[model samples]
Target: MPPAHSTRPAIAFAVAAFGIGTFSLMDAAMKDLALAIGAYNAVLWRNGLGSLLTGVLFLGTRQRIPMLAVLKLHLWRSFIVALMAVSFFWSLTVLPLAEAIGLSFIAPVIALYLAAVLLGETIGREAIIASIAGLGGVAIILVGKFSGDYSDESLWGAAAVLFSAVVFAYNLILARQQAQQAGPIEIAFFQNLFTAAILALAAPWFFSMDATGEIPMIAAAAGLAIISLLLLSWAYARAEAQVLIPVEYTAFVWAALCGWAFFDEPVTLTTMAGTALIVGGSLVAARAKPKLVEHTEITTA
Candidate 1:
C-alpha cells in the first residue's frame, strides 16, 4: 500500500499551500480570460484544452477502463462542476479575486451540512458551529461590499459566487465518492473532457470566435490547473486531512497578491475579518470530518 500519511506535517503543509498557490494563479488567468471573452467562453475553452492535456497524461499511464458506476459519477460531477466554474469565473470578472475566494470558503462548511442530510451523517456540534461561522463571514462580506457604492454587476457577482458555492458544496459530496474510485489524473481527465462536452452543447448561442485568440492563456490555465491538482493530490494522499485542509485558506493570500499585482485590486479589512471566520469555521469542520474524508477535498479548488 502507499504511504497513508505524511511523515512530515511541515513539508506536507507547504506542499498543500503551494498547490493552493498554483490553483489561485490559475484563477487569475481565468479572470483575465473572462474579462476578455466572458467567463462561460473562457471556462469552456480551458476545459477543452485541459481535456487534451490530461488525456495525454492519462493515456500515458495506460490504466484500465473505469467501472460504469465510476464513469457515471464522473459524468455527474462534470455537469455540476461545469455550472460551478462558469458562475464562479463570472464572479471573478466583477468581484475582487481575494473577496471572491473568501466568499467561497463557505463551500466546505456547506458540504458539512450536505453530508449530514444526504449521507445520513450525524450533525455534530463542530459542523453546526462551522455553518454559523461560515454564514457570519458571508454576512460580513456582503454587508461590507454592498455598503460601498457599486454597480449592479458587482451585486450580481457576489450572488453568482454564492450560487456557485452551493453547487460546489454538492460537488464535494460526489468528489468523496469519486475519489474512492479513481486516481487524480483519471478524475481530472474525465472532468475536463466531459465538462467541456457538457458545456459545448451551448456553443451555438454563447461560443465566441474571440476565444481563438485566447488559446495560449487558456492552455496555460489548464496546465496550471493540472499542476495544482497533482500537487494537492500528492499531499492529501500522504497527510491527514486536518493537517492539510487549513492550507486551503492560503488561497486567500495568493488571491490577494494576484488581485493586487495583476489587477490592482485592493483587499479590504472586511474581507480579512470575514475570511477569518470562514477559515476558522472550516477548520472546525475539517477536524470533525472522518479521516477517510481526506480524499474528498482533493478534487476541489
Candidate 2:
C-alpha cells in the first residue's frame, strides 16, 4: 500500500467533488421526502435505515465495536449531527434548494475560526478577510430576502439553515479529532446508530407510516449520504484540509442545477452574487496556511 500522503491531490479533489455531487442529490431527495411525509418522519426513517445499512457493513468488515469512551465521543457527535440534519432538512422543506445550499457556504468560514480557537491553529490575514466576505455575503442574502415578498416561513427557513451551518462548523472540527481515532466506516456506522437512537425518542409523536412508497427515495438518500461521508473521510485522511476545502463550493453549482431541474426554482441574482462572495472567501481562507506546531513524542509501555 502507498503512504497516506502519497494520495494525489488531484485524486482527492476528484473524490471530494464526487462526494459533493452525491450529497447534493441526497439533499434533493431528502427535500422531496420531507415534503411528501414530513421533516421529522423523513429524518427518522433515513437515519434508521442508514443505521441498518451501515451496521451490516460494519459487521461484514469485522470491525470491533467501539469501547465505551469512543462510544461516548460518537454519541456527542451524533447529537450535534442530529440537530444539524434536522434543522437543515427543515430549511430545505421551505427554502429553494440552491438558496439553502448557498447559505450553508458560511460553514467552511466558521470552521476556520473554530479550528483556531479549539485546536490552537493560527488564523492568517486571508482567513480574516474571508470571514468578512462570508459574513457580507450572508448579509446580502438576508437583505434581499427582507426586501422581497418574503414570508415568515422563508425567514424561519433561513434561520434554520444558519443555525445548522454553525453546528456543522463545529462538527468539522470534531470530525478531524474523530478521524484520528477511527476509520470512516466506524464513524459513519455509529453516527447513524446514535442519531437513530436519539431521534427514536421523538418518533412516537412525529412518526407516520403514511408514505410507504417513499421508502425507496429515503433509502437512496441514506445510501448517497453514506457514500459521500465515506469518500470525504477518506479524502480528508489522505490530504490537507486546506487542499480539499475549495471542492466543497462545487456543491452550490450542483444544487443550483438540481433545484432548477427538479423544483423549477430558478437561481436568482441574489443567490449568484451571495454565492460568489462566499465561495471566493472560502477559497481565500483555504489558501491560508495554519501555523505549524511541533510535538514531543513520549513512548508508553
Top candidate when judged by lDDT against the true structure = 2
Who wins the TM-score comparison? 2
lDDT of 2 at 208: 91
Error of 1 at 106 (Å): 2.9
Count of backbone clashes, every candidate in sequence: 1, 0
Q: Per-residue alpha-carbon lDDT of model 1 for 1-301, expressed as tens digits? A: 2223323545555776788899999999999999999998998899999999999988898755677777888899999989999999999988888779877876766676676677565666765776677678767865776675878898899899999988977886676456555777888899899999999999999999888998889999999988987776566554444345445555776787899899988767887787788678656655553433333222211
**For residues 1-301, what per-residue lDDT tens digits would candidate 2 score against the true structure?**
1222345655666777788899999999999999999888888889899999999998999777766776887899999998999999999988989888778877877787777788665666776776777667656765664465778999899899999989988887787666555678888899999998998899878889986889899899999999988887776655445445546666776798899899998777776786688678756755555432221111122
Pairs clashing in candidate 2? none
Model 2 residue runs over 4 Å out of place are 1-14, 125-146, 239-247, 273-301
